[model samples]
Target: MANEIAGLVVIVTGASAGIGRATAVSLAKLGANVVVTGRRAERLTALVDDLADFPGRRLVVPGDIQDEQLAQELVNRAVAEFGRLDVLVNNAGLGHHSALAEMPLADVRTILDTNVIGLLAVTQTAVAHMKAQGSGQIINVSSIVGQRPFPHNGIYSASKTAVNFITRTLRMELRPYNITVSLVYPGLTATEFGQAKLGQSGGNRFGLQGIPAQRVGDAIVKAVRYGRTEVYVTLFDWLFTHINRLFPQSIDWILTRRS
Candidate 1:
C-alpha cells in the first residue's frame, strides 16, 4: 500500500502551517508529487525548501482559499503540472472562539467564508477533474468539535458540521466516478488555528488539550492509501464521537459540566 502513494499528484491547502503543512511534507516524503497552497507566500516557499530533499516534486501557490478563482486555478495547475490529479487534502480553516450570539459578524463571516464556502469551491473544482480522470481522492480535515459542539466554539463547530455533511453527500455523488471522499476529524491539535482567531492568551481555552499536527497528517496519508471514508486521528476521539452518538444526553451532560 505504501507504493500506492508514490508518484501520485496531490494538492494540500493551508500548506503554510499546522496540519496542512505537516500533511504536505508527509505526502512528499512518501514520493507523491505535491502542490501546496496557502495565504503566506514566504511560508509556502519555506515549506517547499523544507521538502527539497524529498523524493517527490513540490509546487507552491500562495493565496487565500476563500477565492473561487483560486480553487479553480489550483486544480488547473495541478493537472497542468502533473498530467493527472490524484488527491486533494482540504485542510485550510479558521476558528472563532465565542458564543454564537456574542461573536463578531466579521469573525462569523471569516469563519463561514473560508471554512465552508472555500472548502466547497475547492471540492467542486477537484471533483470535476477527478470525474474526467476516472479516479481520485479527497481528504477533508474537519475537527472533533464539529461532531460534538462545545461552548464558545459554536461558529467554528457549525462550519465543520457543514463540512461533514458535504463530505457525506460527495461520497455518494462521486462514487460512480471512482472518487473517494474522506473526512478527517482531528481532536485538539497543536497549531496556530486558535491563535489566528483569539490571540495568544484566549486561544488556549478554545478546546481540549493539544496533540502534534503530524498525527493528523499521518492519518490523512493512511486514509488515502486505504480508501477510508472517515478518520479520527486519536482512538479516544473516535470513541468520544461514537459515544456521543450513542448517548447524546449523557455527552451533553458532560459538556454542560465542563462549561
Candidate 2:
C-alpha cells in the first residue's frame, strides 16, 4: 500500500491549512504529484514551499471551492500539468455552530453551498476525467458529527451526512470504471475548524481534547493506498459511530444530558 502512492497525481481541496495541508504534505512526501487548492493563495504557496524537499511535483491553484469554474480549473490544471489524475480529496468545507432556531437562513445556505454543492461540483468534474482514464480514487472528508450530531452543530452535520450518502452512491456508480470512493469521518480534530466556525465562539465545550489534524491526513493517505471504503481517525470515532447506529435512542439521551 505504501509504494502505491509514488508518481500518482492527487488533488486536495482546502489545502491551505489543517487536515488538507497535512494530507498534501504526506502525499508529496510519498512521491505523489499533488495539486493543492483553496481560497488563500498565500497559504497554498507556503504549503508548496514546505514540501520543496519531497520527491514528487507540486502545483498550487488557489480558489474558492464554491466556484464551479474553480472546480473545473482544478481538474484541468492537474491533468494538464501531471497528465493524469489519480486521486481527488474533497476536504474543503465550512463549519457552522448555531441552534436551529437561531441560525440564519443565509448562514445555512453558505454552509450547504460550500460543504455540499462545492463538493459535488469538484467531484463531478473529476469523475469525468477519471472515467475516461478508467482508474481513480475519491476521498471525501466528513465529520463524526455526521454520524451523531452534537448540539449547535446540526447544520454542519447535515452537510456531512449528505457527503456520506454521496460517497456511498459514487462507490457503486463508479465501480465499473474502477474509480473508488472513500469516506473519512474525523472526530474533533485540533485545527482552526472550531475557531473558524460560522457561529458561536466557545469551541468544543464538551471538555474533550481533539486529535492532531495530521492524524486525519494520514488516514486519507492510507485510504488512497488501501482503497478503504470508510476511514475513521481514531478507535473512539469508530466506536462512537457504531454505537450511535446500534443505540440511537441511548446516544440521543446522552447527548441531551450533555448539552
Candidate 3:
C-alpha cells in the first residue's frame, strides 16, 4: 500500500522538544506537511530548519498552548497554510511532581491548564475544521501514569487520566464526522520533562531507564497510520496497563511500597 502519511497535513503541539519534536520529524520524513507549535520560537525554528531536507513543508507557530487564542490561531494557521488538516497531535503538556497536599495551587492550575484545558482547546478548534472536511485523526499523548498514578506524580497522572476520558468521548462524538481519536501512553520517556517539572523532580522513581522520546514518536506515527485506538511504546507498556486493570489492589500495594 502507498504511504498514508505522505501528503497528509499534521499539526503537532509542544513540537519544540522531546516527543513532539521527534514526532514532527518522523512525519516530515515520511512526506507529511507538518505544522509545529511551542512556546519557544527559536526551538521551533530550529526544528523547521533541521527538516529542511525533507519533502514535506514545515510551518512554525510559536506560542504557549495554554492560551485559548493560541489554540485558535494554531489551527487556523495550519488550515490556512496546508489547505487541510488530516491529523492533530495533542502532545503539548506540563508535568508536576509535588504531593497533592504539598503542591502549590498555582502549580496544579498550570498543569491542568496545559494538559487538559489547553489540549481540549486545540482539539475543539481542530474538530471544527475536521468536521467541515469530514475526516481527521486526533492523537493524544497521555502517560502510563494516567492508568497507575505514582505517589509523587499524582497530579500529573490525574491530568492524563482526564485526557484518557476526553479522548474516549471525542472518539465517540466525532465518529459521525469520520474523525478518529487515539491515545498514546508513553512509559517514562527520556526527555527534559523531569527537569522541567513544576516541583521536586521524582527522578526516575520507577527504578528503570526511560525509553527514548523517538520511540514514543514512532508509535504515534504508527497510531496515525493504523488508526490504533491505544498506542504504547513497548509491549511492557501494554502489559502494564492490562495487568494494572486485572490486579488493581495488588498494583496499589506495589506502588505503596515504591512510595
Instruction: Tell me the deviation in Å of residue 25 in model 3.
Output: 0.6
Q: Write the per-residue lDDT of candidate 2 for residues 1-259, one digit (tens) a residue.
A: 4438999999999998899999999999999999999999999999999999999999999898877899889999999999999999999988998898999999999999899999999999999999999999999999998888888889999999999999999999999999999999999888888777898876466888889999999999999989887898899999989989999999888888877
Q: State, as a TM-score between 0 and 1, how close model 2 is to the true structure.
A: 0.97
Writing each residue's lDDT as its tens digit, candidate 3 over 1-259 gives: 2339999999999999999999999999999999999999999999999999999899999999888999899999999998999999999988887778988898989999999999999999999999999999999999998988888888899999999999999999999999999999999888889887888866466689888999999999999999998888999988999999999899989988878
lDDT of 1 by residue, 132-246 (tens): 8899999998999899888778888899999999999999999899998999999988988867864113634435578999999999989988989889899999998999999
Candidate 1 TM-score over all chains jointly? 0.95
- CA shift at 192, candidate 2, in angstroms? 0.6
Candidate 2 at 139: error in angstroms? 0.4
Ranking by lDDT: 3, 2, 1
Question: Which ten residues in a row are the worst by lDDT in model 2?
Answer: 196-205
Model 3 gets an lDDT of 0.92
Among all windows of 10 consecutive residues in model 1, the one with the lowest summed lDDT is 198-207
Better of 1 and 2 by TM-score: 2
Model 2, C-alpha of 121: deviation from truth (Å) = 0.4
Better of 1 and 3 by TM-score: 3
* lDDT: worst 10-residue window of model 3: 201-210
